[model samples]
Target chain A: MVNEVIDINEAVRAYIAQIEGLRAEIGRLDATIATLRQSLATLKSLKTLGEGKTVLVPVGSIAQVEMKVEKMDKVVVSVGQNISAELEYEEALKYIEDEIKKLLTFRLVLEQAIAELYAKIEDLIAEAQQTSEEEKAEEEENEEKAE
Target chain B: MELPPQIQAQLMQLQQLQQQLQMILMQKQSVETELKECKKALEELEKSSSDEVYKLVGGLFVKRKKEDVKKELEEKVETLELRVKTLEKQEEKLQSRLKELQEKIQKMIPTAQ
Candidate 1:
């Protein structure tokens, strides 16, 4: 009986560990989603700029240089694997939107998995408690008989 | 209660298994991320209407033929897919071993009233 309780406790620990891992994964996804949203907003605003407009383009993240917007309709977007594709403003917007959608769906799945694991942990704790209680009652009854 | 030496050994083994599993999982995640990027790039390449595409090479964007870039990305995706599968298999085996060791140790524990 004691062994069973110990095993249940161990199982609960494992479940909790898994939940922590999932939470970290979700945190990363959240950060990525935030970045994607910011990019989407920036792209939208950039699309509104008139042709030949002067804009300050950041150089090395610290200094910015005034640059002329040669073409407002086209932008180069990273397509992954270090490759960049020149895309129209509207196409780039759609790409970001699709990425955000995919990440949100993945986040939802992780959340659901965490919820299920929490339920399992609760059940395991209850089982351990009930087993311990039964053992205590049995000991008390035995003592009474002896008296 | 003192744990038997056998149970102690199993517990140590369980800990090792857990560490190995964690390492494998991290590796899988990184590879999966790369794979996702590769797939996305391929999709974008297919949809791209531009005549020129550039691949970043050591801090510089080197122009490459679209077909060549597509081929490279496709190969990378295939390799990553295989790697992820292998890591997944290792993860599954380690998990089952961990569970078995836990059960064995649990059985060895002396029952208390």
Candidate 2:
């Protein structure tokens, strides 16, 4: 019985550890999602720029260089895998929106996995309680018979 | 009472297996991320209107043919897919082994009652 209790405790400990790790992963995903959303918003705001519009480009956090917007209809964006492509403004918006959608879907999957782990933990706790209660009842019965 | 040597050894082995599983999970996550990036790049490449694309090589943008970049990304995606599959198999195996060891230890220990 003692070993059984120990085993249950160990299982609970392991579950808790896993939950912690998963929670950390979810936190990272949330951060990434937030960053992507911010980028999306920023890109949308760029629509205000007109062709040949003068703007200040920040240089290494020290000085800003004045530059003319040669074209506002298209922008260069880093798609991924160290590759950048020239995409029209509308296309860039679509790309960012797609990324956000994918991340949201991934986050939902993680949330579901966490819920399943929580359910398993609850079941284990209930089993541990039942085991201990049965042991206690048996002990009390033995004591009464001896008396 | 002290735990028997056999049980102690099993517990140690279980701990090591748990660590290995955690490592595998981390690797799987990283690989999956890379795969996602590759897929995203491919999608963008297909949708792009430009005849030529720029690939970042050693902090420099080297202009390349669109087909060449697309082929490179496709190969990367294939390799990453294989890695993810192998890691998943290892994870499944380790999980089952852990469960078996736990059950074995539970059965080996005599019930106090």
Candidate 2 residue-wise lDDT at A9: 87
Off by over 4 Å in 1: A60-62, B1-39, B74-113
Candidate DockQ values, in order, are 0.65, 0.65
Worst window of 10 by summed lDDT in candidate 1 chain A: A42-51
lDDT of 2 by residue, B25-98 (tens): 99999999999989988988888898788989997999888899899999999999999999999999999999
lDDT by residue for model 1 (A1-147), tens: 978977997899999999999999999999999999999987776667867878898899799999877776887888887899988888988988998999999999999999999999989888888888999999999999999
**What is the alpha-carbon interface RMSD for each candidate?**
0.9, 0.8
Supply the global lDDT for candidate 1.
Answer: 0.89
For candidate 1, give the lDDT of residue A11. 93
lDDT of all predictions, in order shown?
0.89, 0.87
**Which digits, one per residue and each the tens of the lDDT, describe model 2 over residues A16-118?**
8988888898899889889888877756655577657777878889899998877667767788899988888888878778878987898888888888888
lDDT of 2: 0.87
User: Pairs clashing in candidate 2?
Assistant: A1-B112
Question: Worst 10-residue stretch by lDDT in candidate 2 chain B?
Answer: B104-113
Cα misplacement distance, residue A75 of candidate 1 (Å): 2.0
Model 2 stretches with alpha carbons more than 4 Å out: A52-68, B1-40, B74-113
